[model samples]
Target: MSAYMVGYARVSTNQQDLTAQRNQLNTLGVPEERIYTDHGLTGTNRDRPGLNQALAAVRDGDTLVITKLDRLARSLPDARDIIEELTKKNVKLSIGGSIHDPSDPVGRLLFNVLAMVAEFESDLIRARTREGMQVAKAKGRLRGKQPKLSKNQEAHVVSLYRGGQHTTAEIAELFGVARSTVYRIVQRTPTLN
Candidate 1:
């Protein structure tokens, strides 16, 4: 089995460049042949084709490297999940740019601490978003995603649906909404209808 220093790079959007990442890995002595790139793919899924192929190609002693933890996954849970999977396969992993190797005691301690901090930070973000929404709602400013149909529009849609004059798809098209929205309104009591 060929021992490989595999590099995985990712970008969330089509406009983002992978060249910089590739160059960095190449400069670090990771051969271009050993780098797997997923451009325009979110780091939210483990189903990346390039990543999968690279992992499959590696032997137990081979190294899997990524620029950073976030480039590999979106959340701590995701990162932890991937790490556990790789560990089970006896594959070595490295966060090539920012993270220290977690093989040693100190490095392992630091990695766990940092992962906890990341999880805490994510929770803060969610809390802030919820608080902001609450404030906006209190101020009478509309908050969250808008319902597909307005109150008056919903009544009209319900009438048409109840009368059975138009199909769900046709009602959806007429109201510039989804078929599910039509169904929801039509299923309501006549008072709401």
Candidate 2:
């Protein structure tokens, strides 16, 4: 059977566009119909459905195409695992139109280096995000979700509960809040004699 190309693409966030990658794959000669994609999924995650489908679509003598190594996998181990699978299936990997030959020592080395760089970049991004969040929290700018009710509203709800004139559901509906909120207010507020 003649060899064909099956393409895979991924973006880490919903806001990120896949047009550039798609166009690159198209330029690399992979048909649009054969291209598979995973949106809003990080490369570190190995269980993406699109990746699985792309792998499954390729058969012996077929080629798997990607715009970049990082788009396939971010970590060295995952990259190696994917390469191994492709090798076993007698399928080839084309990164930006360049075929990866696992049997070649230099090619393997280059692939590993690329995978390591991708992993390092991912780690750096995670660390920076954590540091930013810490700074925000220290400045009290990261205060969690605001209360659903104002202090006066909470006091009124508690008073209504204490008065035994309304059910939790009734109070919840009256204030457009959940029954759980009314229950929480009742639990936290002190009972007056």
- Please list all clashing residue pairs in model 2, or write none if there are none: none
- Model 2: per-residue lDDT, tens digit, 51-147? 9999999998898999988899988899999988887888878899998766567767877888899889888999999999999999999998999
Displacement of residue 50 (Cα, Å) in model 2 is 1.3
Error of 2 at 27 (Å): 1.8
Candidate 2 to truth, TM: 0.90
Record all residue pairs in model 1 with backbone atoms less than 3 Å apart, i.e. clashing: none
Write model 1 residue lDDT over 27-121, tens digit each, in one string.
76689988988888876666888778766766676777777666776667776776666666666667765544445566556666666665666
Runs off by more than 4 Å, candidate 2: none
Best lDDT goes to which candidate?
2
Which ranges of candidate 1 are over 4 A from the true structure?
Answer: 1-3, 10-23, 37-53, 73-92, 98-102, 147-186, 189-193
Worst 10 residues of 2 by lDDT: 101-110
